[model samples]
Target: MKIYDEKHLKNIVLLGAPKAGKTLLAEDMVFEAGIIHRRGTIEGKNTVSDFHDIEQERGNSVFASSMHTEWRDYKINIIDTPGFDDFIGEMIAAVRVADTCVMVINAQHGVEVGTELIWDYIDQFQKPVLFAVNLVDHPRSNFDSALQSLKERFGNAVVQMQYPLNQGESFNAIIDLLKMVMYKFPPEGGKPEKLPIPASEKEKADRLHNELVEKAAENDEKLMEKYFEQGTLDEDEMREGLKLGMIHHEVFPVFVTSAKKNMGTGRMMGFIDNVAPCPAEAKPELSADGQELPIDPSKPAVLFVFKTHLEPNLGRLSFFKVISGEVTTASELVNSQTGAVERIHQLFIVDGKSRNPVDRLVAGDIGATLKLKDTYTNQTLHAKGYDITVQPITFPEPRIRTAVIAFSKNDDEKIGEVLHKIHHEDPTLMVAYSKEIKQLIISGQGELHLAVCKWYLENVYKLHVDFESPRISYRETIRKSANATYRHKKQSGGAGQFGEVHMKVEPYFEGMPEPTEFPVRGKEVIDLEWGGKLVFYNCIVGGVIDARFIPSILKGVMEKMEEGPITGSYVRDVRVMVYDGKMHPVDSNDISFKIAGMMAFKDAFLRCEPQLLEPICDVEIMLPEDVMGEVMGDLQTRRSLIMGMDSKGNYQVIKAKTPLAELDRYSTTLRSLSQGRARFTQTFSEFSSVPFELQQKLSKQLQEVEAV
Candidate 1:
C-alpha cells in the first residue's frame, strides 16, 4: 500500500440502493488493484465492507466501511456506505469527509427509492456525484432506458463514458468511447481480448462515440475547435476534456459495469485515478477563530474525526480526515472544545479490515487512532495554536421511538451500560429512561434500524431488551378559563396548617397557534407567560393569609401543572391567576399555599377539555410508479393525508403527514405491499388535537393500557 500526499489523495464515497452490488464492486476494485487475492462474495462471509457480524447476517452494509486502494499511481480512499435509508447517518458522516460520491445503481431496477434518498443527501452536501450502472448482466437490464433515466434525473450532465457492447446475458464487455476500442471478455473467465469495432454495432458505436466527444468538447475550447476541424478529437484530448469537466462538475460520467463478473472494474479504477479531483482540487473552507482558515498542509496538524468504531479489545477507533499539516504517531494535538492537549497514538491507515502502520499522514489523508482521551466523534483536534470547531455531520432528528424494558430483570443494569456504549458509537441513536412507562427508550430512523440495533444489543451485550411501540408524549391543557377552589387542613402537627386558594386557569399560547406552542422549555413550565399573569393580588385585605403562605400555595399550583392535568407528562403555557385566599397568620406558611395551589390546579384541569394531542410525522414515501395507487390507499387507511406527489423517472415521491401512532408498523405494511421495493422517511410534524371520533377510541385505549 502506498500513501499519497494531500494533493494526490482522492476520497470517494460509494453510494447506491441496497443490494445494488456496491460491496461486490468494492471487492472487485480491491481485487483489480492487486490489493486482495480474489473478490469476496456476500454469501461466503468474506468482503471488504459489511465485515461486521450484524451486517453479514443481514446481507447488507449496515455501516460505512473504508478501504484504501491505489489506481494509476494515485491513492483512492473509497468509503463503502450503506445505501438503505435507515443507515443514512453513517452515509452523512462519510459525505461530510469526502470530496466526491460515486452512486451505484442496479442496472435492472434503475433509479430506486434508496437511490433517490441517496441523491437527496448528495444534494444536501452539494458535492459532485458520478453514476455507476452496475449489474448490467441481469436479463432485465436495459442500457438505453437506464441511461436515459439517469440523464433526465441529473439534468443531461450525465453522459455515458463506456457503452455496453452487448445486452443482457450476452453482455461480455464495455466499449471504451475515448479510445474507440472494444475490450471483449472470453467465455468462462479468460483474459479480455482487445478487438476492433464489430461490424454489426459499428453504426451504433459511432453515434455513441460522437455523443461522448460532443459532451466532452463542450467543456473544453481546444477540444471543441479540434472537433470542428477534424470532426472528432483524439483519445488523449478527449480524456483530458472529460477529466476537466468531471472535476469542475460540468459533466457527470456514467460508467457501465457487471459487478458480479468483475467486468469494467479495471476501467472504472483508471477513470477514478486519472480524472477524479484530489484534495488540492477540492479544498473546503476551514473555520478558525470565527473566520475562514486557510487549508495549509505544511502548518500544524488539524484534523476532524468524522466516524467512530467500537472494537472488541481496541476500544474506540476514530476515523479522521487531516485538514492541515501532518500527524506522526505520539505527536501532541489539542482538542478545541476541551482545550486539553492529548498525544496521538497508534496512527495507522485502514485497509479494509486490516490496519497498516504508518509513521505519518499528510493533510487530506484519512487515518485512524485508538483510544484518545478527550476526542470523540465530530471532535476537532489541532496543534495548540488553532482553536476552531470543525463542522459536525448533521443528522436528522430521530422521528420514531420505542420504549424498551429488560426482558428479564436480571439484565436491567447491563442494558444501561450496553445502551450507553452503543449511543456513543452512533450519535444518531438516543437513549432515555421514561419515568411514566418505567421503560428505557431507544429511538432512531425507523423500525428496521432500531430492530438492527436491538439485535446488536441482544447479541453483543448478552442482554434481552423488550420493545414496545412508541407512546406519543401528549400534553394536557384547559381550553376556557375556569375558577376552582381547594383547602388543605392538617391537624397532625404542632402548628396546624390550613390554607384556601381560589385560582383561575386560563389558556396561554406561544407564537399564536391560539392555544399553546408545542416545544415549551423550562422557563415556560414554571412561569407560563402565554395567557395572563398569575396575579397574587393578595386580596387578603385584613392579612388573613400571610405573604409567606401565599407563595407556598402558588408553588404547589406550579408543581401540579408540571405533572400535567391528564397523564403524568409535563404541562405548559397556562397561567394560574391567583386572585384571593385565606390563611391563618400563625399556621400559614409558604408550604401551605403551595399545597393549596396544587389542589386548585388539579380540580380545574379535569373540568376543561383535557384532550390528548398525538404526535404527527411528515412522511415522504418514494415508490415505483406502478404502486402509487396502492400506496395512496394504504396511507389513507392509516388516517394519512397525501400532501402531494412528484414523479422522478419511474418512481413517485409521495409526501404525506400521518400520526406517529398509526405508523408504528408501517415498515411491515410497506414491505408486504411493495414487495420490499418501497421505503420511507418520516419526521415529527405539528401536534394536533386528536380528531373527535378517534379521540374517544384513543382515550379508551389509554385508560385500558394504563390500567393493565
Candidate 2:
C-alpha cells in the first residue's frame, strides 16, 4: 500500500437510519474499489463492517467500522457507522472525523426518524453530505416520492445527480444527469455499460441537467457568469463548481443506488473521489484552545483517537486520524492529556477485523495501533514540545439508568474491573457507584444500549449481571422550627460521661442571618458534602457549654442529618443554634457532647413537620406530532409539569419537569408508545417535596424493607 497525501485523501462516513443498507452499501463500495473480491451481506453476517459476533447475531451494526480503498489514485477512508439510535455514540465519533457524510436513505420509507436524527448531527458538524437512495430495487421502492420528500425536508439544496432509469423490481439502469448519459447494467448487476440517453428520457434529462448546471454555477461568481454566457457549464467547470458548492453546503447531490444489486455504486464512488472535499478542503481541525491547526505532513505530529476497540484476543486497538504531520512506526509521541510519552511500535490500517500493517500514517489518513499505553478514545497524541491538544469528540449524555447487580457473589468482585473495560470501549456507557444509594448504577443511551453491555459482560468477560430499578435518592428536610433538649449520662465504673443539650432547629435557606434574639458567641456555617447547608450559631451567654465542645455538637447534629428522623434519608436546609446547654467538667468530653447533640437534633427534627423531597429532572422529548396528544397525556399521569412546546421540522419537542422517581424505564415506555419514533434527554433540575400521599407510601415501603 502507498501512503496518500492530505490532498488525495477522502474521509467519508456512511450514516442513515437502521435497515437503510448503509453497511451493504459500504460493502459494495469496498468491493467496487477492488479492496475485496466479493461483497458481503448483513444477513450472511460476514460483511467487513458488521464483523462483530454481537452484530452478527443482531444483524445490525452496533459499532462503527473503519475501512479504506484506493480509487482513481485517491485513498477513500470509509467509516461505516451504526444507524440505531442506541449506538449513536459510534456515529458521532465517526462524524467528528469525517470530511463528507454519505447519508443512505431507504427508498421505500423515504425520510425516516433515524435519518432525521442523524441529519441534525450532520448539520451540527456542518459536513458536506450526499444522499444515496438505497434499496431502489425493492418492490415498494418509490424514488420520485423519496426525492420529493428530500426536497421538502432539506430544501432545494438536494439536487439529483443521478436517477434510476427503471422503476422498482426492474431497477437495472441509472441516468446520470451530470454526464448526460445512461448506464445500463447487465442482468447480473456488476459494472454498467455507458450509452446515450434513451430518446424518451432525453427531454427530462436535459431539464435536470440544466438544473444541475445552474445549481453548480450558483456556487461561484465566475462560473455563474460563464453559465449565463454559454447557457451551461462544461464538465470540468461544473465539477469544480460543485466541489465548491459542497464545501459551503450549498449543494447536496442525490445519487441513486441499489446496493444489494451493486447498481450505481461505481458512479457514487466516482463522484465522491472527484467532487467531495478532500481533507485539506474540509473544515480545518481545531485545537483544544480553539485555534485551527494546519493539515500538513511536515508539521509536528498530532493525532486524535476517536474510537477504541477491545478485541477478544488482540487486546486494545486505538483508531485515530492524523490531524497534522506524519506519524511513523516506532516514533514516540506524548499523550496530551497525561503528558506521558508513548512509542508507536506498529501502525496498521484497519479494515474491520483485518489490519494492514503500515510503516507510517500521514496527515488525513485513518488507522489503528495496538497497546498504546497512555492513549485512549478522545485523547490527543502529539510530538514532544508541540503541546497541542485536539478538541475531543463530544458524546451524548446517558439517557437511561439502572442499578447493576452481580448474579453470583464471585462476580461481584470482578464487576467493577469489567465495567471499567466496557466504559473504556464505549465512553457513553457510564458506570457509577452511588455511595448514598449503595448500588452500582449503569447508564447508557437506552435499555438496548445497557442490554448490549450486559451481553458483552456475560459473553466476553464471562460475568453475569442483572439490572434492577435504582433506588430514588430522596432527601428529608423540615418545614418549620422547633426546640428540643436531651441529657446524656453514662457510668460504667470508668469516667462517667454526662452532658445535656438544648437547641433550636429551623429550616434554613440561603442568605439567612444568625438569630439575633440571643447573643452570638461563635458561628460556623458548614456546607454539607451531599448538598444544602448547616448553619450553627453559638449563643451561650455565660458559656453554659464550653466553646471547645461546639464542633462536637455540630458533628453530632450532622450525624443525625445523615440518617434523618423521618425516613433515614439525608437531611438538608436546616440550621441549628446551641443557645443553651450544660456540661460536666470531667464527663463533657467530645463523645458525651456528640451523643447529646445527636439526640437533641433528632427530637427537634421529628417535632418540626419534616418532609420527603424527591429529585426533579428537566426532560425534553422529541417525537412526531401525531403522538403529541398521547405522550402529553401520559406525562400528566407521571406528575409532570409541562414547561413549553416547540417545533423541529416534522417533530415536536415537549419540555417538562418530572420527578426522577416517576421516570423509571421512561425510555422504554416512550419507545413502545411512539413505536420507536421518539427520543428524549433529561438532566437534573432541582428537588421538590413529594406529595403527602406519596410520602406516606414511600415511608411505608421503606419501613417494610427495613423490617425484612
Report clash pairs, candidate 1. Answer: 552-590, 552-593, 552-594, 553-593, 553-594, 556-594, 556-598, 557-598
Residues 464-544, model 1: lDDT tens digits: 877888566665666767779888788885988878887667666654332232222112234443222332223344554
Model 2 agreement with the true structure over 1-708: per-residue lDDT tens digits? 899999999999999988899998999989988989988987788899999999999888889999998999999999999987999999999999999999999999788778888887889889999999999999999999999989988998998998997768988899999999999999778899999999999999999999999999999999999999989999989999999988998799999999899999999999999999999899887888899986788898999999998888888899999998899997899999998998999999888888999999999899999998867889999999899999887888888899989989787769988898788779999988987788998889988898789888899998888889998888999899999999999988868998889999999998877587778888887888878888888888787898888888988998988877767789999988888989888877999999999999999988999899999999999888899998999999999999999977667899999999889999888988998888888999999989999989988877888899
What candidate 1 gets wrong by more than 4 Å, as runs, is 188-191, 283-285, 288-295, 408-414, 434-439, 509-542, 648-650, 692-708
Candidate 2 lDDT for residue 359: 97
Candidate 1, lDDT over the whole model:
0.77
Worst 10 residues of 2 by lDDT: 511-520
The Cα RMSD of model 1 versus the native structure comes to 4.1
The CA lDDT at 667 in model 2 is 86
Q: List lDDT for all candidates, in order.
A: 0.77, 0.90
